[model samples]
Target: MQKRKHWNLGAKLAVAAAPFALLALLSISLTLWVSWQLDGGAAAVNEAGRMRMQAYRMSLLVAAGERTLLPDARSEFERSLALLSHGDPERPLFMPRDEDIRSRFDAVGQHWRQYSKHWLDVRPADNRGLREETARFTGRIDALVAGIEAHMSRWTALLNLMQLATMALAVIGATVLLYIGYLFVLEPVGQLKQALERIQQGDLGTRVERNSSDEFGTLADGFNDMADQIQAMYRNLEAKVSAKTAELQEKRERLEALYEVTSLIATARSLEELARGFVGYVARAVHADGVALRWSDEANRRYVLIASQGLPAYMTDGERCLRADECHCGAPNAPPFARVIPIQALEKEGLQYCSEAGFETLVSVPVRLKDRLMGEVDLFFHAEVDLSPSARSLLEALATHLASGMENLRLNALQHEAAVSQERNFLANELHDSIAQSLAFMKMQVEMMRTSLSAHDETGTRAVLDELDAGLRESTGDVRELLLHFRTRTNSEDIEAALQATLRKFEHQSGVRTTLTLREQGLPLPPDLQIQVLHIVQEALSNVRKHARAGHVWLDVQQQPQWRIEVRDDGRGFETGDGPPDETHVGLHIMQERAARIGARIEVFSTPGKGTSVVLTLPASDPTLLDLPPLQAVS
Candidate 1:
């Protein structure tokens, strides 16, 4: 394995370049110091040369002593020379006695002294000698001054050339240092920065590679090693994740199989059918020898085997009584095989059963609805099989679903039966009140006419005629009442409106008083129940009119959580023990049947001198029942 270079290359490069940067700064300082010293030397020489020229000019003026010369000339010349003795004065003429320049300055001063003496002596001589001598000496002094000026100009040009060369060298050195920094430092750091950015972006494949055997190279090597390790770890993690994912997929399929079995049971229409299907599915799913289902019928207080499959005939068909301690499947100390199992204890005790049933192990699940024990499902295996936790959970879930479905089905059957009975009662009332009564009245009228005609003589014919007319009127009224009864038989008519119309017609026809009272409103009774209620009212009113022969009828239709209809008559009444006339007692029987169909009870009250009152009380309509078509009157 290669040694890893985990350190950053850019940071290493910066560390390595720090000494070179310091060296470059030191070189720059040395060059500046040397140039400054050279400049100072050149400036001193120039200032000294300028002072020499001034001294020579003043000496010539004093030697000539022309009338233009003032007495202040000597003083001014001494002051100018004194400036050279002060430290770093206005002139650069500080030459020591040992210097070659000091010897030249002494020789120049001796020559000027000689010229001054000669000129001063001749100034008092003849005019011609003075003029000639002064001209010659002045020409000599001007030539010497010109030679000194030429020497100083040459020296100044040399100093300027040295300074320019030093500046050029400093500029070139700085440029070289900058280029080196960019190549070795900035360029490598930029590459390292880009590599780090790629790593941050999740490109673990990035590797740093520097050619030199420096700190940067070590960093590159480390980076490559780290990337390699990370890649290896990532691959290993992927393999482990793949294995776990496959395991989860297998578990999901198993759970789906369990869900399918439960769904099949839920859709089964009857308990027997549902249990048969459930057992078959479970047997296949769990590979059981057989499955059995038993339930406790609360009303009968007996445990019955409602369904079974792949089981012995004795186990399914035989009548069995369940004890809290005994196994119904002929197993010893086996799981409790009752409709209500101790769900919480099923896992710990694993079900108490007898081993004699030739099964090594059995699992029993209780079916409960709203805390009531409705049934149990039992599966028997030939030998103990290792059932997984998921399998046990699925079984429990299925049991819960089965419990709810069974309860719902039971309620549905009861409601259907009640609806059928209500329909039958409604039909009976329509037949008796409308069709039967119409036929009976027609028969009575025809017989009466026949009897009168048979008894008639020619003179007594008018009397018979009057009797026939009265009977015909009564028959017509009966027929009209029958028609009205048929028209109102349908329960869909607003019950209150229908009852009011019926009473109004009765009052109009018989010239009797009628009143209706209602209590509670907005009760949505089912059509069948409504029709049964309507018939009860109609029958009570009919009996009142025919038997009680009451002058006034008070019909009260009331609603609460329960439905009730009561009809009272004020007329000659009979004893409660007195039955309806033998030929016409069907009305009372019809009324009782109608009340029973809607889960209602009817009561009748009467006395010899008081009126008759019939009351019908019924269970209220269940709002959740399925809607049915409106009833149509038979007519």
Candidate 2:
């Protein structure tokens, strides 16, 4: 097939209109030529008629015997004849080229020449019937006029025929133009419209046919290219949307796993429970077949399996304890990053148990807290599995959470141990200062009583016996006081209630009238601090019972402007020479030690024959109390 030529819309339209334009121009040119030729026909006819009129006028002048008029009329007749012979171009008078008309014109001119000469001969013989002669010449003039009229009539008919032919050609040209427009413009536009409709209706596969190398063809090619791009973009968009949805789903799973592990950490009472729950959740989240959690020593040498979600019983037992240098799974010293290693890549001795279980892939994630390598988590897969960055990150996050949970449990255990040890020490101190000191004094008194008995001093022995009996009673009371202090527990909600209970018990045991005055002004002290304060108050009360010998003891507690407590006794008081507390005043020392533990100050005021008052003042800005955790069980 021959390649077609390309033309734009303007060129196509111009080509379609060119033939009609030429035909119209030719038609108009033909009409103007015919009209121009006929334009002088009327003038020629009028001039010929004027010649006949001049001939008749000349004859009449001759008949009138007016010789002067005859010459003038004769000259006028000649002038007309001359004008007819050579037509006036400026006046637009043109003689017809028809042979009949030309012959008749010549006859008219020849007859007039002969007739004019005879009429002017000046001889009567030359003159015949003037009318008859003039009439004969005028008849020839009439023939010429008739010939001109006949020629003009034929040209007018030919002009009408030419106009009719032009109209027919114009109709044919318009019909052809309409057909071309339908083929080139309307049909192509229709096809393009249908293709656009298909695309708009969601059929991205629609394409236009490129049948011609024209504007429509270019348009078709462009449309096809655009459709290709749109279809490609649509496909790409669908892929992107699918990938995004999958990414969001993966993220959601990770978040859920994190939340489950976080809840486990918060609620689990032991590291084992937290690790078990963490491994189980991680295995499910990442679609792993088996998961194991391990803990290593500070030096990262020994690994102890803390928890496992899935594994053979034998494999779990055999791999329960492995060193970092011997195990392929929990090698914390190898690298800090989580990695997916093929089970077969490991040495047979390191992970032969995993390979024997038909596991193909293993992912080891390190659990770290700060800079210390805590342990590693191992995930086993039955089939080969590739971990994306997101998946690996999720596993690492779970490991980090596990590390934090384990560390928190460890810290809590240490804190509990420390608290227990401190309580034990406090009890020991209380025993040594009170009961132990009392026992040592009784021992010395027994020695003195023995010495008196050996001397046979009856008064000294009786006195020593009374003193020993008093010492025994005092020791019994101290034992009971120690027992009360050991069993004492403070109320967390209200310290006043615990203080009231202590005072009631003290008044009942010792028969010493006790009064408690409490004034609260600010937020209550923390439970730990309150417990220490209550213990100090108890110690002071114990001293009042043993040594003060007061009738009434008053305990005052103030919470405002700093925690302040005072134990006042109206009893015979000993002198306090402030160098250090008397070695025997172990109660005062114990009270001061208890006060110092909670950032409080203690003061003892006593005078001979006057009362004694023990005061405990806590600083307003005691930062140590804020960090003290809730008091643990005393035991």
Candidate 3:
């Protein structure tokens, strides 16, 4: 069944007023009706009394034989009687309550008419007959008067009853009005004040007892429902705020950890060191029991454990290296992200690495550089861990950072290796160009001397022996100069000072007038590049002294838009095709190789019987940037 809605304020007021209104209306209507009845009865009684006066006047006039007065009185009495029987415009006859009053009015009207007819026929001469007629008419008028008197009395009694009814109705109206005021207005107002006080006291649980079906009841219920909803909302909002604050705090910690890890990785000098820092910091940041990193040693075809921390020694002792099919690191079937696994699950799958290592959970992330997988990092936990998506994303980012940093370190190391290899090749070429050529010349001279001795030409043998001695001394001097070149450093002076020193040494050694020009002053190069430049300059000067057969050389180091090194000689220059199999041209080739290693270009300009110029020009390199691996191949 459907329940009715509570009455609104207007409806409550109307309900309270309705009974009073109805009683008041009934009382007013009864009183008005009773007063109307009394007025009609009193008017009829007055007309009857007036008719009695006119009837007495008519009798006096007839006894005096005044015919004119007789007609006037008779007409007036008859008119009053007619009006009582029927109705007049001014005073209409009343409808009686019963047949007795109506019949009395009819009898008075009939007797008066009969008396009027007889009095009109008889005359002033028949006084006795007139007197008899008057007596009979007077008697009827008296009866009529009595009836009017009784009618007035009855109407008066009815008016009194109506007055009592009015009083009773008024009493009912007053009682109902008082009850309405108490229940609807006064009582509800008191309850509302109590409700307000409770609300002011912060008691949201306060609820009014809904006893009446009115607006106040609805108001109380509404307030209660609103309070409940508000309280629930407040609680829910508080919980959400607390949870959000916790989440933000956690994010702040993670960000701080990442910042520290980034700084550590940046300063780490080697891949192993970087991996150790990365794993340690990541484990501490996200809270893990242990971390182990493995790198693939491709040349050895095995995984080498590069970094391990917070793990049992037994796990890393003999297990530092793993073959392809022996580890659970997706060696052949690589997953894209870190694979989280329970130790029990791994044990079930016959992968006992985590289980034997005494870890309950294991997570492995494969380090990659683009398409190639480099290694895998394994994270272990002593307790169960459910990886959230956010956690997994953070782990993936960490893995990416490790892989990129390690790869950069490896590349740097490889660059150093290449630099060393290049230097070795250059030195071997230098040996062939200077010392080896001298030795070959000595061997040829001895062979020639032996041929002369066999033919008995002593002059030819003596000349060849002299040449051989000079060659030995020149080779010895070349070796000493090579040692000096190694000792030249910029610790005490800049490149310009070093260049001037090298020119002075060349002038002393070869008796060549060496001059150096600076195109842009304060030209700078890194220590390693400076060493390479010095060695190349030494080789060029040695060539000028030993083979150019000239007296002067010029060294021009310039910075236009970039750096350029030029060594010029005013001596006999070799042709492009002079050295067979590139043997005599080996010095030029080695210079070009050195230039190429440092991302520079070497240009050789020469004409036979004129001069030779070797120039290495490099793009402008920023001195402020820290670039590439350590180069120590100047030897």
Q: State every prediction's TM-score relative to the real structure.
A: 0.50, 0.62, 0.53
What are the per-residue Cα lDDT tens digits for candidate 2 across 1-635?
99877688879888988989899899989988888768778888888888888887767767766677777777777777777678777877888788888888889878877886788746345445888888899899888988888889988998999899899988988999999999989999999999999999999999998988788999999999999999999989988999999989989988999999999999989877888888889988998999988888877788898889889888899998897678677666567778888887656675488888989898888889988988889999998888988887888888888889998999989988887887788888877887787788888888988999899988988988888898789778878877777677765657888888999999998899998888876667767777778788888887777777799998988878777899999987887885323457447788878777677799988886677888999888743456664455453
lDDT of 3 by residue, 1-635 (tens): 89887677788778778877877787788778767776776777778778878887877876777777776777787788667766553554554465676777677778777776666646634667766777777777677667767777877787788788778878877887778788777887787779779877877666677777667777778877877886787779988999999889878867877787678768889766787788888887778899888887654257788888888887787668887657565363567787887776554643465687778888888777777778888888988898888778778777777778887788887888887886666667767766788798889888998999999998888898898889889789978876686577876426888888988988888788988888875546777777777877877777677677787798988776677888899888878556412255246676676677667787777788888888877757763242534555463
Q: Which candidate leads in TM-score? A: 2
Candidate 1 lDDT for residue 25 = 68
Global fold similarity of model 3 (TM-score) = 0.53
Model 1 TM-score relative to the real fold:
0.50
Q: In model 3, what lDDT does residue 272 have?
A: 65
After superposing all C-alphas onto the true structure, candidate 1 shows an RMSD in angstroms of 11.5
lDDT string for model 1 (211-329, tens) is: 65656567678777888998788879888899889778756755765677667655777867776777776676666687876776664245566666676655444425554434433
Give the clashing residue pairs of candidate 2, or none: none
What local distance difference test score does each model get? 0.61, 0.83, 0.75
Query: C-alpha displacement of 614 in model 1, angstroms?
Result: 26
